[model samples]
Target: MLVLSRRAGESVVIGEDVTITVLEVRGDVIRIGIDAPRSVAVHRAELLEQLETVNREAASPSEDAVQSLSAALRSRPGNHAG
Candidate 1:
């Protein structure tokens, strides 16, 4: 990671559009402001991770769901073996 030190009121620019500005520094906590275009997506790291986990769980079929689907397919009208 590229690390740089900036005091409050100092800003860092990324690409040609995004700007990250330090707003306040209180003890160990620091507050920052980001300026970007509407098309750019900015998300907190932890929140993004949570969203990814939820999406993965939703996309994957459970064992019970797979079994139920298999059973339904086996019992369908034209699916029987002669």
Candidate 2:
């Protein structure tokens, strides 16, 4: 892990396009601003973790769930199930 101490208004650059700047410091909480191109994605760690968990769950469906979904879709109007 890279560790650096920066005051408000100070910034660190990554490669040629990304910049992480410290915006404010209030006691123990620090606010930061990031500058990156639209192609880049930035997400809070917890949110990213949650998304990963949801993706994993969706990827692996239980047999009961698959059966329930299949039944529901097959029961729809104008739909046929084999």
Candidate 3:
């Protein structure tokens, strides 16, 4: 990990297009701003972990399980007898 010091309104550039800036500092809390292209995704550590967990769960589904779910939904009777 590369460490650098930045003051409020100062920024650091990552790669070619990404920029991270120090927006505010209050005692121990520091607020940061990021600028990146739409194609790039940025998330907090906890949120990223949640997304990874969801993706792992999605990728581990069995084909038969998915087909069974589809069949169950299709077989459900709809109420149209009003």
Per-candidate alpha-carbon RMSD to the true structure: 2.9, 2.9, 6.8
Best by TM-score: 2
lDDT, model 1: 0.96
Candidate 3 lDDT (Cα, 0 to 1): 0.93
Candidate 2 per-residue C-alpha lDDT over 15-62 given as tens digits, one digit per residue, 9 for 90 to 100: 899999999999999999999999999999999999999999999999
Which ten residues in a row are the worst by lDDT in model 2? 73-82
Model 3 agreement with the true structure over 1-82: per-residue lDDT tens digits? 9999999999999999999999999999999999999999998999989989999989899899899987877777993443
In terms of lDDT, model 2 sits at 0.96
- How many residue pairs clash in all the candidates, one count each? 0, 0, 0
Tens digit of per-residue lDDT, candidate 1, span 1-82: 9999999999999999999999999999999999999999999999999999999998998999999998888889988664
Candidate closer to the true structure by TM-score (higher is better), 1 or 3: 1
Candidate 1 residue 7 Cα shift, in angstroms, is: 0.7
